[model samples]
Target: MYNLGGSVYWNRKTFKKWFATRPINLKWMLLVILVFPMFAATWEMKKSSGFSPLQLLGLLVFAFAFMSIISKKTKAPNLFFLFYVFLFLLITNLLLVFFYEGSFSQFGDTIRTILPFLLFFYFRKHLNSVIDIEGFLITFLIASVFPISTLYYEILFNPIREVYNTASRGGGLRLSGFYADLFGYMSHLICGFICYCYFYIKYSKRKSKHFIFSNVGFLFVLLICLIGIYNLRHQASWAVSLILLSMFVYFIRKQVSAFQLFVFFIIALGVGGYFYTQIFETLFAKDIAVYEGGAKETAALNGRVYLWKKYYAFWENFNVLGQWIGAGFAQHEKSSVMMSGGMHNDYVRFFFSTGIIGILCYVSFLIYLIKKTLKTRIVEFKFLLLASVIVILMYSISALPLLASGALMYFVVAIASQINKNIV
Candidate 1:
């Protein structure tokens, strides 16, 4: 009974210090845990009785973030602009949902779309240094090896032959890995590979043994990703990757000689030309045909142009304020277009779902993020932010990268904001 309470208090203080100072890259590990399972969530959704692995992981991350805030271990950023834009969008969407008698799913989906921004802030708080960012990227690259390996095995062995029978379809082999489909797999791969390239460029000259190992590991991961991209036969991913590579070259031009630049350009052009030729021969070489009604058709743009036209036609029915929320979801199902997926364009999707206000909010958000990036003092971080923005913009033209797993784009912006604030 002699000072028992004092002893317990001292023990608690010691524990907190140990927790705070513990090494082993806890923040990087947390980011990896948060993101890596997303690749496997689609597959796990079928096997699980309730929430999928991805959802559980999200809840866990959220719990940790909430506790951190409560304990004062980390403070949330003063994201007044972002908070205002998000709140406005949410209020408008809620009003629309009420007026249109939208389903709960519609309201929930809207919330889900914006939820990533919250997670982005959580990550931004933890990723407080360049080393933290680098560690996170490396962890992601390592975690990616599992999915990539599974994709290769499935392609080569076809363990589930019935499930993969569609690989020989007209568009060539499409390896979905553990994702819902090939497109989902491509999205993750594209973003992860771009981050790997950024890290490689920034750390290639470091003399640290750990960095040397990281470089070699990243090279292997890059090779696997390249092969996966080829097998997936996604033109959008290919185009984005080519654009990012070119940007990387331009980014490093000052560091390399003129002759080096020329050689790099020549190699890039040669490789790109060869890849384009193969894509044309293998994926787009369908025979032209004329219907009995004298209609000529070719497999141009993989029918994306026709899909865009149909969505545009549907957009005509919406008023200036839009049909409220869930317009894209509701209309896509009712329309007789027979499209295989959601609206391929994010801008069009937003206009239909949230109307002009939605579009304005989105544009303003981009402008703000870009302005912040421009003000960043770190050159590597600035280039990474700009490259990511360009890639996301390019991706938005052909696909909706602002929703679903595409929320990762906001994660990049959040990181940029943290860097600008001198928090990282």
Candidate 2:
């Protein structure tokens, strides 16, 4: 039944054994869950309903995942799960016709919200296979070609900013790549950075296979991750970068001498200060202008303070029930900011999209994750899980971390590891 994602041994009787119903192969499913969709961003040919490669890939994942729940066991839990996805698709289509006036953009918005949660839920349930850290990291790097290639394409081709999918802001061309916006691409870069550093750290400990971690190629990929994040240049990016750097340093604290560290920082300061204007101006260009206006609160947050005010007022207007349960996806998108996918805050996004009840569920799940993180004995797995949580919470303040697969996938992997002691 899980043939779609599980591996099958090949032999003379392979064809005869193909019909055997296998349990869900957790690792391959993780690969598919991690790889597709955003990878399809490199070839998004249409904005209309059902034409997008992402939409199609998302539908396939939803369908297969739900069906796996059904095929695994014919019980109340599985049936309810199957019905939920079907009902969502039905309501989404109906809402598109009436509430959204046939807007595929709204259709796209609704599906994106649903996919991430389903991906997490499915992985969390099938726990045994999530332990393949090395194999998964390799898969992640291979899948990264989709978004990373888009970065180089933009740099090499220099497409017209006016018409192409290129994202630009603050007089700088962002490395958004094939993603429709900067947040998604930047979020992926955050994941890439972790994977690259993981390989580098592993290789430095001892000699290893070329495919797992290459010394020369590792540096190249690491550089790309940093450069892409630098070009994207969001306030959230800076926060995430500092968090990542601090985490990395903390992990390798015992490996380096004080003199080595001092020299590293001195060289970094010298190189960065050498082109002070170019780097500083490019990074803080918009913030500088906003600060000059004397709007200290707004400047500090890049206008999120203002946006949050409006959202607060709008949310206040919700009735007792609406405030508790949320204004469904289609109804919530009536706000222009939401339709364009710019809440500038995940709490605000959650309030509008899922309301108090959903928020509680999310927060509770987070607590459970923290407990699991504490229980894990594996040092490396523990660090990855904790870091994923830190990244999500940090990005939550200024960006939509929940929506990014990069931010959520590792957490899902962490959950899988906690269930099995020997996964690594």
On lDDT, the leading prediction is 1
Q: Give the per-residue lDDT of model 1 (tens digit) for 186-254.
A: 645766766765655555344542432253474466566667777777666777777876776676566
Off by over 4 Å in 2: 1-39, 42-44, 48-50, 72-108, 127-131, 156-169, 183-188, 202-204, 207-221, 255-282, 285-293, 296-300, 328-340, 357-361, 404-424
Model 2 residue 420 lDDT? 26
Worst 10 residues of 2 by lDDT: 160-169
Q: Which candidate achieves the best TM-score against the true structure?
A: 1
Q: Estimate each model's TM-score.
A: 0.71, 0.70
Instruction: Provide C-alpha RMSD values for all models, in order.
Output: 8.7, 7.5
lDDT of 2 by residue, 205-250 (tens): 4443454344346446556766776666565666676567556556
Clashes of each: 0, 0
Relative to the unseen true structure, what is the C-alpha lDDT of residue 28 in candidate 1, on a scale of 0 to 100?
Answer: 33
